[model samples]
Target: MPLILIIDDDPMIREMLITAFHQENYDVMGADNGKTALDIFRTEDVDVVITDIIMPDMEGIETIREFRKIKPDAKIIAFSGGGSLAPDGYLKIASSMGAQYTFQKPISIKVLSEAVKDLLGSCKKKL
Candidate 1:
């Protein structure tokens, strides 16, 4: 199965994403922050990354940047609840920086499943 890593500070968000991807049979890993998520990447062949925009440590945008340095062609999805602070078109920035897509918070499982399938399918073809 393809591997997916989920990075979010919110416990509920991480659990929800983990449950969704697990049910789809993908090997899923979760991290409480971007730093831990980066560590998980070192130990796993993660096919896709779903990360939040903000966190207490490292921050999702910085994580994405470094992930690209090590794995330039990584497949990543930037997700966020926004929570009040946004650096203006953050999603667009993420896309330009290498994220395959940016999804807003409260996404339906069906939508998420389809997006994950599409992104992972594309990534698989590259592999």
Candidate 2:
């Protein structure tokens, strides 16, 4: 089974993602902040990462950079509302940094699940 790491400061958001992924039968892990996410990334076998952009204790952009350093092929999906910058701006920057997909706030779980499935399928093809 593919392992997915979900990073978000909001407990509700984290739980939502976890539930969504679990329903799809994907093994899931949750982190309340970027720092914890990175630590989990270092120790666990995470195939995909779903991160919130405005997290404290490391921020999602920085976490993406570090994840790239540790695993250049990391599959990341970045999501955010409006932070200091607009959601589009932050998600754009995340895409450039290494995120494979982006979602705005109030994301549809079905869409997010399909995106992850598509991305994971692509990765599987490459391997």
Candidate 3:
């Protein structure tokens, strides 16, 4: 099964995604911050990462950059509720940092599920 890592400071959001992905038959892992997420990333063969842009202790942009360093071809999906700027602004930065997909807060679980399937499909094609 594919492994997905979800990083968000909001416990509700984290758990919500975890449950959704679990129902989709994906192995899921959750972290409250990018720092903890990265620790899991380093140890696990994570196929996709869904991260909040404005997290405490490392933030999404920096985490994306670090992920790229560790695995340049890593599949990443970034989301933000916005902080000091609109969610679009932060999502744009995440895209430039190598996030394959971006979403605003209050994302639809169906859309996220499709994005994960798409990324995983592309990963399979590359291999």
Kindly give the stretch of ten consecutive residues in candidate 3 with the minimal lDDT sum. Answer: 118-127
Q: Any residue pairs clashing in model 2, and if so which?
A: none
Clashing pairs in 1: none
Cα misplacement distance, residue 26 of candidate 2 (Å):
0.9
**Tens-digit per-residue lDDT, 62-87, candidate 3:** 99999999999999999999999999
lDDT of each: 0.82, 0.91, 0.93
For each candidate in turn, the TM-score is 0.89, 0.95, 0.96
Off by over 4 Å in 1: 125-127
Q: How well does candidate 3 score on lDDT at residue 68?
A: 96
- Candidate 1 residue-wise lDDT at 53: 83
lDDT of 3 at 70: 94
Better of 1 and 2 by lDDT: 2
Number of the top TM-score candidate: 3
The prediction achieving the highest lDDT against the true structure is: 3
Better of 1 and 3 by TM-score: 3
Better candidate number, 2 or 3, judged by lDDT: 3
Which stretches of model 2 miss by more than 4 angstroms?
A: 125-127
Query: What is the per-residue lDDT of model 1 for residues 1-127, given as tens digits with 9 covering 90 to 100?
Result: 8888999899998999899889888888999898898888987898888888878978888999989987887889887767556644677677778988787777677877777788877665332
Ranking by TM-score: 3, 2, 1
RMSD of 2: 2.0
